[model samples]
Target: MPSEPQPAPYLPDPRIETIAEWIGDPVAPAAFPRHQLRWHNRRWAAAVGLDGFDETRWVQHFGQFAPLPGNLPQPLALRYHGHQFRTYNPDLGDGRGFLFAQMRDAGGRLLDLGTKGSGQTPWSRDGDGRLTLKGAVREILATEMLEALGVDTSKTFSVVETGEELWRGDEPSPTRSAVLVRLSHGHIRIGSFQRLYALEEKAHLEALVAYCLETYPGSPPPPGAPGREEPAVILLHQVVERLADLAASWMVAGFVHGVLNTDNMNISGESFDYGPWRWLPRWDPRFTAAYFDHSGLYAFGRQPEALLWNCAQLAQALSMLVETAPLVAALDRFGPLYQQAMGRRFTARLGVESRGPEQDAALIQAAERAMVETGLAPEQFFFLHRAARNAGEDDFGTLLRLHAPTVAADDAFWRQDAPPGVLIDEVERIWAAIDQHDDWSELHAKVEAIRDLGRHLG
Candidate 1:
């Protein structure tokens, strides 16, 4: 029998030249074989503007991409300071990762194409610029799942399994390495601003602030606008609003980012790193995901507070760029913004038709208490709640038993003929929307409807 040859990798539009030309970086000579990697589609990457990125070729090229003409990303060795695990660490920048370049999407949104585990550079410091295959796979799964769950997150553009083996103390010996391309707004962290503040470089801090404002022009100006005197207060307020909104989103999704270090906090307010992150299965306020979280600093219930703390760090850093009084006042708005966001999130999740702060609070508290007392998995309960209108009590009982066995004892509680609450009507509305749709489109449309309702009610 004759043997068949493998197919060549599909090369999409050779606009790689355009991307290269934009960055002025030459494509490195080394090329990883496409067969040696796991390729996944990034909807957001397509939503942005990246196309035809060969993860395998990218891994093979490694650090050589910097010197390639028309392909070299305008490399910036960012300077940043951070408090890692509560202690100040002044010398952490792009330890291994680097921002390759920025590209404008069809919608005119600027997205940064950055590389992780692309090998060592001047900032590598006593570490290897490599990411484990397991780490890469975990990141891919995390990104996909989070996006589906509607969490504001960075998209993984590509993942390439390099043929070379590396060693890591955290796992078994001779671990495989991989490269990850992430599409994000920018990599400018709170630490980046802090670094300049530490050096007392007011000019640089102001420059960074200006750069941020230019990057995210839609951001509302702080208290004092065009004709107003103090622009720093306005800038501070804008940052506070974005930070509050991001924190609220995280809380709504039950996401615990193991590390909330200043370096991990993005000024543009987007979830970036997936390291040591976990989605809460149940509504436990104390759930911690990161193994090294000895102090319970970044727990599920504490995420909002942790974010406020990070925002405080940012405020301190911005003091170098703005006045102290306005920064403090701007920072004060964190509580109100978070409260409003939380109210909106909870409202949607419960499908409450009427808006009443007291009523909403009571409903949320009741749900939380019921979830905890019943030991129900948060996701399962919410999923069942979304389907409750048509599925009937028995169906919900079956689902709860299948997905969250701990709540089996409470089947009677869930099935009891009680008066209709906020969730009941909401569930009925969501189910009605699903019922009206055809079978082929019902499942997807239903899930989306529930999610949309959750967003509005939350």
Candidate 2:
């Protein structure tokens, strides 16, 4: 009798390989992957088939620049050109990062593992390819808080303290450096298509469109778009829905992703590359997140506009391959999608099932006005109103009474002395403790508290 054969060991199934040629440029990471391990997302690792990976295995794949099994043979530095602050910048790309690998998540969705501060590439024109430790810390915090707020955002997969000191004008000089790995939905940015259009590679552009539609599948096209089946028009419609959700989600989360460049906008609608991001201290529509955003282009309330503009650029790129009418029809759906998504998200964040879009809109408007008049931080606003907590207060009484009664705030989280806040001052204090004392206890404590908040929000 013959014994039954056993199946081979589990390995990640990837899709990036199929379109690697037309999408990315093969490149090796600069220098050795010799960074000291600092933080690792063990939970995500298990979902991606690297659960048992030790320090060596982890650093080899993430820090030491070694390729992973069933993944790309070498790292790929993706090419993209974006309209930075309404100005066309052909020189922009992955200047300090590259696509490390791609894998499927537990839910069978494709995910990308990308690197930041691994090394420089051809796009590293005049910059030192490095990431400040503060930047890595900030990204981890941003993602954690955003996820807690139910925003579609990237997870900081790993943080390795690269043994290097980098100088920059933004932060303190001689600052520590780190290499970060991010696990995300996908790395295909809207700018990726812009580059193809700029090069006049219609064939590559079409191929890229097909690859995107097949890879990052989104909602079906709207009813009015006659060419819903057309690859280019369908993709345009899908990206519109996604970016609309992203913009609405951010508005509900009180987040401002300072840089809304076309390159920063992902086709999958997941938020990543957190630079100069901020949560609103109060409900100020004119609040700007970036220090140099003199024009308030990507201000807190204007996020939807910025995202809509980026999607418009994507539509413009797709125009090179498809007609204007269907694409334009798809583009027209952004405003309505944003409005409805915002209503839904706000109601959910308030811990109430949305009764109707109009009611939800009214509640959101009332809440916003109350917060602005009372000078309440967004976190405090949401926390205090968790199922309409403190509903009897002068600040929120009438506003909350205008709606159907919400679930009572019976959870222990509502009884907490104070809710967690990661505003700029709070973030600065966390960083100050690290910089001045070299102590990370506060950072670890904050992350734990953030997870606790997520649990409470559940």
Candidate 3:
């Protein structure tokens, strides 16, 4: 494996403080009955210079909500509005979670340490601001698997089992409870801008645009892009590119985010907040992750559309600062960017060199058709025919023959009979070990195996 980056010292730079008071509200953490450290991501910890913390100190900061030195004195449950399944709702914001702190990674990229099930906030409404232990475990698995599959996603930084019994209708009643912290690129969502737009807060909207351009620093829009020099247009373009790549990564990984609300669409474009997520058991595009999504609005196939719709809403917000035409031009970039990203990521997943866009697209279509026709799971298909091997005389085989192999299928990960996967059944099995016998052995093994796959893929 490549040498890990030297850990950066704990540098607290809560840049969000500059945005003023209206952006968020101060909130208190819950008084948990107990704090038992369940999961500590040592790899990410080492990357951020927090690996030196012993178990006691780790629990105090992450579980007990003790403020890290030089960080925010109080958590901020950010204020925002979002479209929940196409219905504009002004009453949406952080309820169970809050921005705990902000720090930089070894590479100087700003990261947010955000919480889930930490406590209740004003946005909590009538619902309890708590996360079930099963929910936390599911999020950990989702992040781990998505990261291994080359998805730019949040890192599950910590999962501490809080001694509490919570009742829920979804699963067994009075289930275990926990608190989670995720390390993310940023927490600024599309809905963040939407809130300002809805309120007609033009000055605040411009300030947000400026702040994002400085802190998140992205490349300007493509040549000839309308209003390419405008900060609002540029921010929109950056989000478009990031989200397009995010959608492609999910498509290639066979991941259904389950919920694609505007609030869930992070400006950093990294995928986070995994709830009711699923991986395709077969190559079915209509696969819906959330059981409540009766209309398949955010189904696996419609993810790109949902994402584009969210981008449109962002364009609507940016219109508060810039001309509608320029923002529309920025939104226009999503389609081609998504197609290009899809081609690039698909080739990487297939372990093959691209034969240009047209050929790549053809190969992708053929491979999808083959998977659907043969009823093969995506993981199985990629594992069985990696590097263009094991492909018989079918349309898929013909397309595979056209592309050059990128890696020989000889690595230990490839040699395994079955690839490391996080399908619902596997996730339930891992959780079952933890729930039934408190045996984390299976979960730990799965994480290691997933990392091994990542190493080989690299």
Candidate 4:
């Protein structure tokens, strides 16, 4: 673990008068971990004007604020049900999480600001609504790493240790409890819409659709026949496109959301709920993050399909709002949109200029086959390929030889044009540029350059 930093001073949002004003009630304090008190996220706090809210006094009086006045949407405790790995569960909503409030950001973007592990709420079921320190740490790491990898993701707002302990059957002793605040576009899930549709709540479904369009009008409407009057159909189409783009982005970054349940699928299409997630070190399409995913439904390569299925559920929910023919037409666009995004990403990763479908497919298949046969880590291969291209054919030959020992008969083919002595010199120069300092900004720039070449080729 990295050395923990001390808590920074609070910087309140200019839009918010106080914490109480933001939440409608005195913000409730829930104690869990002492070590978890370290919230040294000054940059993020400053970005959202939360630097003024980082004070120790505010920490002590977290649950004591009066409601803040604003155009912030009222965050009702929404109701919804979901299928956990294909098994239907009737009771679920804000389980161990709650939408604290919704507010527009500095960019005039509507975002739902919520807290996980705030406290036990109506949907607590048999367990506490508190999060473990381990969970918080993992989320922090995920947010930072994923953002660097260029994925659209939720950002962590704040983390606080509540100085309490809770036990679960998975662990021998009780773990420390903590609260985490996350900033997202909207917390409404595909399941929220699905549940209403399932229960034949047409009025509520229409209201939800209307709310989404009003909140996120910039999003594209359904495939054909657009207008505000067709809010339900338009909203459904918007969700499908978002989900397609989101899934493609995940695939491009070699990310596995692990769980793609309807409840985990955000209508905004932004990646949310970073639980049981993993990044691929190698490009195995079948790789999965969740150990219990026996069916391989949400495997690395199957994310797009899983998203389509989830969209289908959303479409079913919207049936009450639109006729079947238009709904099917809207659903049809998912495949093409997903493929387009995937094609762009695959081309970007390969350092090859993107041509059309044939060229993209050939390059993608070649890379996939090479990775599987050579047992080379995807990142390692990508780095080496970029280095080879930058250093010329001779240096590339040397890289192939260096990595050759890791493969089998392929070594003979790769070593045919050995670049002799100069390869190491070129590699060292590039490596120095990449690893000269511990600062990640310099490192990320180098990686982005390599990605840029691929995009240019595409």
Q: How well is each residue in 67-147 modelled by candidate 1, as lDDT tens digits?
A: 322333344445578988778897676655666656556545556666787766555689787777667656655554455
User: lDDT for each of the candidates?
Assistant: 0.59, 0.83, 0.89, 0.61
List where candidate 1 sits over 4 angstroms from the true fold.
Answer: 1-35, 52-74, 221-229, 350-354, 387-458
Q: State the weakest 10-residue window (summed lDDT) of model 4.
A: 418-427
Indicate whether candidate 1 or candidate 4 has the larger TM-score. 4
Separate clash counts for every candidate: 16, 1, 0, 31
Off by over 4 Å in 2: 1-10, 32-34, 393-396, 402-406
TM-score per candidate, in order?
0.74, 0.95, 0.98, 0.75
lDDT of 2 by residue, 34-143 (tens): 47787787656766777688898888778877888878788888899999999988897888999987777655667788999878888888988789889998998998
All candidates: CA RMSD in angstroms? 11.8, 4.8, 1.6, 10.0
Better of 1 and 3 by lDDT: 3
Higher-lDDT candidate among 1 and 2?
2
* lDDT accuracy of residue 419 in candidate 2: 81
